[model samples]
Structures are given as C-alpha cells and as structure tokens.
Target: MLRGAYLILAGTVIALPLTPEGLADGPWWPAPAVTGTSSGERYHAVEPRLADIIERREKAWKAAAAQDYDRLQHRSARLNRLLDSAIGVLVEGEATRARRQIRDLEDDLRTQTGELARLRTALVNAPASGCADSGGSLVQDVKCALMPDARTSLQADIRAVERRVAELRAERTRLLSDLTGSLQALGIALPASDLEALLVLVSADRLIDTYAAYRSLAQVNAALIRAAEAADGDIEVLKRYYGFHVVLVEICLHLHEAFLEEIEGKWLPRLAVLRSEAEAAGQQARRLLAREDAPELRARLSANVDANGLSIQAADLYAEHLRDQARTATERWAGLYRRHQVALNTYRTVALQGDVLSVMRQSNRGFAELVRLELPPLRDFESTALRDAVAELSERLRLSKL
Candidate 1:
C-alpha cells in the first residue's frame, strides 16, 4: 500500500505541466512593491533619473531580443570554436595543467616564506638564560631553558621549508615561461605572467574574473549549452532575459561605485583625520602625565586625556568596521551580478538550437527563475537613509511598472 501511494504521488507530479507559478516558485518571482517610509520618501526625490535609466535599458534589451535566433546560433558556434582552439593551444604538451600546478606551488611558497620569517624572529628573541624559579617546579625551569634549543630547531625547519619554497618557485617560473611561449606560438597574446594577469583581472571585477577562470574548454562548452537551453530556443526571450540581467548588473555596479566614491571621498578621509587627532591626543596625554606635578589638577587633566583617547579609538574602530561592511556588501553584489551574466549568456547560446521546453523542464528552470528575482541587498540598499535619492528613484521605477 505504501509503495502504491508513492507511485500515485509521483504520477501526479509528472502529469502537472510547467506553469508561470511553478517557475516563480523557484527564484524569479516579481519584485515586491516598495513600501513608503521616511527613507522611501527621500528615495523618491531621485525617481526621475532612475526611471530614465531603467527605460533606456529596457529599450535596448527589446531591440536585442528582436534578433534572429539562427544568427545567434552561428555566432555562438563560432565563439565556441575559437575558445576550443585557444584551449587546445593552452593544453598542448600539458602546459595548461602545468600552469595550474605552478599556481598552487606559488601559494605554498608564499606560506613557507611567511613561516620562515616568523621562525627567524622567534630565534632572534629567544631568551639568553633559563627561567628563574619563582615558586615553580625544577622541571618547568629546565623546560624554559630549552627555549633557545627549541628556537634552533625551528630555525632548521625554516631553512628546509625555504629550500622547498625556492625549488617550487623555480619550477613555477619555468612552467609559466613555457606556457607563455606556447600561447604566443598560437598567436594568442597572453600576459607574460599568468598569475599576475589573473590578479589584475580579478581585481577589476569579480564576476568577469570567474568567467575568465573557466579552467577548461569543456567547461566553457557546457556553459554555452546551458545558456541556450535556458532560453527554450527562443532568440527573443533570450534577448529580454539577457537585457534584464544586464540592467541588474548595471544597477548593482552603480550602487557599489557610488558607495565606494562616498567612502573614499568622505568617510576614509574623515577617518584619517580622526586617527591623526587620536594620536595627537595620546601624545598630549603622555606629555601632561610626565610634566604636570599638581595633584588635583593633574588628576583632572589625566582623566580628560584618557576619556578623549578612548572616544577617538572607539570612533576609529567603528569607521573601520563600516568600511569593511561596505566592502563585503559590494563583493556580494558583484558575485551575484556575475552569476546572472553567466545564466543569461548561456541562455543566449542554447536558444539557437536546443529543445527549449525539454531543457527548461530539466536544468534551465532555476536559471529562468533567478533572472527575474529582485536582489534583496539592492532593494535594502535602495531603502537606506544614505541612498534616499536612489530609493526615491527606484520607487518611481516600480510605480511606473505598475
């Protein structure tokens, strides 16, 4: 009876057709209506500019969506061929794989270098004499005297690690040189140093960095298949989906850029001034403590100095914490933007030739849903007091949609 019931439930689910509600259930639900508040009111003030941006993005997306699916398919195929050729050149003679190994070895070398430095410092600071017996056991005093010997052992370990690190660096450098030569032979102009190039790319934008680090040609091929499948073989739908994500990415990027501008232009400078002020206050307190001889007056001045120092320290720490928080928020949004881009691009490629409905029912369902979902962080950021103008603009955009 239990087996029969389970079979019946499975049959029911299988019989149910995919609907908008089903798709919405996964991730792409419509944005919630923005509620009114003091913050929201302030956001409304900049609604016109935000509306203009959204309208312009929507128009561009509509135009792109109108392209022929067949043409897109051809373009996707060409891109894939080019990408595979590049990967072929990279993996020739196992050069690509070697580069990856070299990267790992370089990381190990960095860790070992830091360890060696620390060990050297410990050796330099090792006590010259044994610990004095201050109501301690004799065994403890003997162990304390062995500190210098322990330091010597650490120094030896450091030397061994240093040698290993040097060997790894040499191997990595040689592999990198070989890889560079191979790519150049293929008419691909890659940076002389793969690691340094990766660092520069990653620093510019985390999302682009992920795409650039696809690891293998096969992964890139799979990604294109997934993208085409997501759009259900419809060029128009794929274009709209791509445009929507582009808008989201733009908004997220703009928000982060604006926040960074405020931080660098205002908050950071203010923090620096505060830090300097705190240092000055500390120096003043130390001098006062040294020079002042009056009992009651000295006591009052010392108390004032301590209080001032504590306040400044607290303020500096709080500012630093805010800066860290902003950075983390920006990184989170950047990562999400990249994921959206990947999903859209994959849909664009797959829409050219795949079984749209079949693929959608399988792997592409979640991808479709994700494209429509409003980013919570972005929504919350829009509602903040600091972004009153932006919030106002966003609210206008929402109302215009209604």
Candidate 2:
C-alpha cells in the first residue's frame, strides 16, 4: 500500500510539464522519463511530438478506407506511368543489347573484310609465282606447284568468307530494323550516338545514371504494339497492380509529413537541450579543474569535462542525422507530388482527356523510385514491426526488375 502511494505521488510529480533544467536528474533529457502516476503506469511517457505523430497516424488509419480510396482511376493512371517508366528502362536495355550486337557485327565485318582482302591478294598473286610470291625458296615453289587444288581451295575459302559476311550483315540489319520498330512502338528513338552511350552505361550497369541519361523521352505512343511484339506480360501487370498502392502512399505521406515536422520542431529541440546541458556542465567543470587544488576533486572535474565534450559531439551527430532524414523525406515527397501533378495534367492532355488510364505521361526524375527516409527513436507505430503500410511504401521499386 505504501509502494502504491509512492508510485501515485511520483506520477503526479512527473505529470507537470518538464524541461531539461527542471529534470535535474539528467536521464530524462534524451529519452525522457517514466511517469509513475500510478502502479499501472510505471513506464516511460511518450514525448509530445511522438504522441502527435501517433495520433495523426491513427486518424489517417481511421479515415483512409480501401473502399473510400479516392482517385483509384488516377492511381491506376499513375501505375501506368510507373509501368511506362519500367518499360522505358527495359526498352532502353533492349536497345543497349541491340547496339552491342551491332558493334560486334561491325567488328566481325571488319575482320571478314580484311580476310577477304588478304584472300583476294593471294588469288591474284597466286598463279603468277605460286610460293615465290611469298618469298619461298625454289624447292618450296616446286612443292607449291605440285599442289594442284591450291587456287581452287583459296576460291572456296573466299566464297565461305563472303557467305559468312553476308549472314552477319543481314543479321545486323534485321536487329537494327526490329530495334527501331520496337522503340517506335514505345514512342522512342535511340540516336546511334545516344544508343552507343546508353549501351556503354548499360554495360557498366548504371541504372540510376542511365535514367539520368535517358530522361523523359520514353513514352508509350503505342505501348500495346510493343507489348504484343515482345510478350511483356510483367510490364502490363505492374501497370495494373501498383495503381492500388498510390492511395496508400498518399496516406503514408501524411504520416511522414507529421513525422518530419515533429523531428524538426520538438525531437530536435529536446536533443539540443541535452547537448547544451552537457556543454554547460563541461565548461563549468573545466573552469573548476583549472582552479581546484584537491586531487580527487580535480580528477572528478576532469571526467565531467570529458563526459560533457562527448555529449556535445553526440548532439552534433544527432543534429546532422535529423537534417539528413528531413532532406531525404522532403525530396521523396517532392518527387511524388510532382508525379501526381503530372498525372493530373495528363487528364487535360489529348490522350488522357477522354481516357484516364489509357496511357502514361512522360515523367521527370520522379519516375525513378519512391524511397522513404527513417525518423529515429520511434515509439508505438514502428511501421516495420506492426505490418505498417508506410514500411511497404518505403521500399525502392526496382523499375528495371519490374
């Protein structure tokens, strides 16, 4: 009964709004302290910023129902745009392969041409002096003449070389034509030079860089034409499936925005207070160390100074971490926002004016992927653990794999 009463008293003490200076017992600075308001509540109290995020997330959960999902058709269109982005990457890859083969063909053609030239040189010079043409001795010339099929053999070899060269040239031509047609079907044109550069990037497997190089030109003038020609069911499926995900993504964006705001406003401030306290404590300790005569007091002050310095260093690192998280989340939000605007604008365009999900728009860098940055020191809605929807959204969709 006495323990219970003490717990209630502790809870009441903790219930008051507290500050870093007010909480003289310093553990509460970084992680806060347990509210011992009652035996039932002998655990750490949630920070206001964190509590606000939880409240916002719960509200979003209550509001965003699957059936109540707004803009399914718009989401579907976004899905198609993402699909086109992925297909564009694949089409770029195919062009890369085609160009590589062309280069190989060009090399083969050069080799065969050189061989043909050598054979022709040999044929013309053969009958005149036989082995003598090649600086052979008189005895060798005699042996060369003894070989009656030498001229015929050379002619046959020339014919074989001619045939192989023709086949390679034909194959190269067909590949070029088919590659061009496929690209045209997807409303793209790979310039020979750009194609070469793209091929090199592809050889290096630079996915993000290739996206930068390729840009917004990859669209679907006639996607079905290409799809039918290539048997790309997977690409079609992405267009069909991920449209549903955009609804959830919008909801998660709200959660993420609240998360970022709390970090910027409160969580960061709390960290600042902790760091300031450490620095102030250290400075005071250091000054005392300079004046103190007692050996034990000096030792204690020196340790305090060291501890405070470490605390300041830790605060700087945490500050940097918070800023990075904010920047990353901001970029992601911007990308998605830009993409949605573009998707909406598509509705006013010629193609999508009448048909919503009939086609995809030309996307900027936003087409790459949607990646989310994490906010540290989470409580309650640790999205990854609780089958949270945001964790799923945070994943980078490998457009190339799609």
C-alpha TM-scores of all predictions: 0.33, 0.31
lDDT of 1 by residue, 1-402 (tens): 011101001001111110000010111111222232222232332233333443544433334553221111233444333332332221222333344455466558768888888888887887543344325867766676556456556666878988887887788778777756644432234565333332221111221111122222122223333454566557665444333333323333333343454445544565556556666887887788888898997898788676666655544443554465456656754554454345445444545554333433333222211122111121122122323332222223223311
Best by TM-score: 1
lDDT of 2 by residue, 1-402 (tens): 111101001001101100001111111112223323222222112222222332333333334242232332333444333332332222233433554466567668879989999998898876653554647577766666676456756887899999999998889768777656644432345554443332221111222212211221111212322332344445434332222223223332332343355456554666666667777898899889999999999999988887677656645654564565567556655544544334323323322233222242221112233322111221223223222221211111111121
Can you tell me which runs of candidate 2 are displaced by over 4 Å? Answer: 1-249, 347-354, 360-402
Tell me model 1's lDDT, rounded to 2 decimals.
0.40
Which pairs of residues clash in candidate 2, taking residues 3 or more apart in a chain or in different chains?
Answer: 11-36, 11-37
How much is the lDDT of residue 27 in candidate 1?
A: 14
RMSD of each: 21.6, 28.0
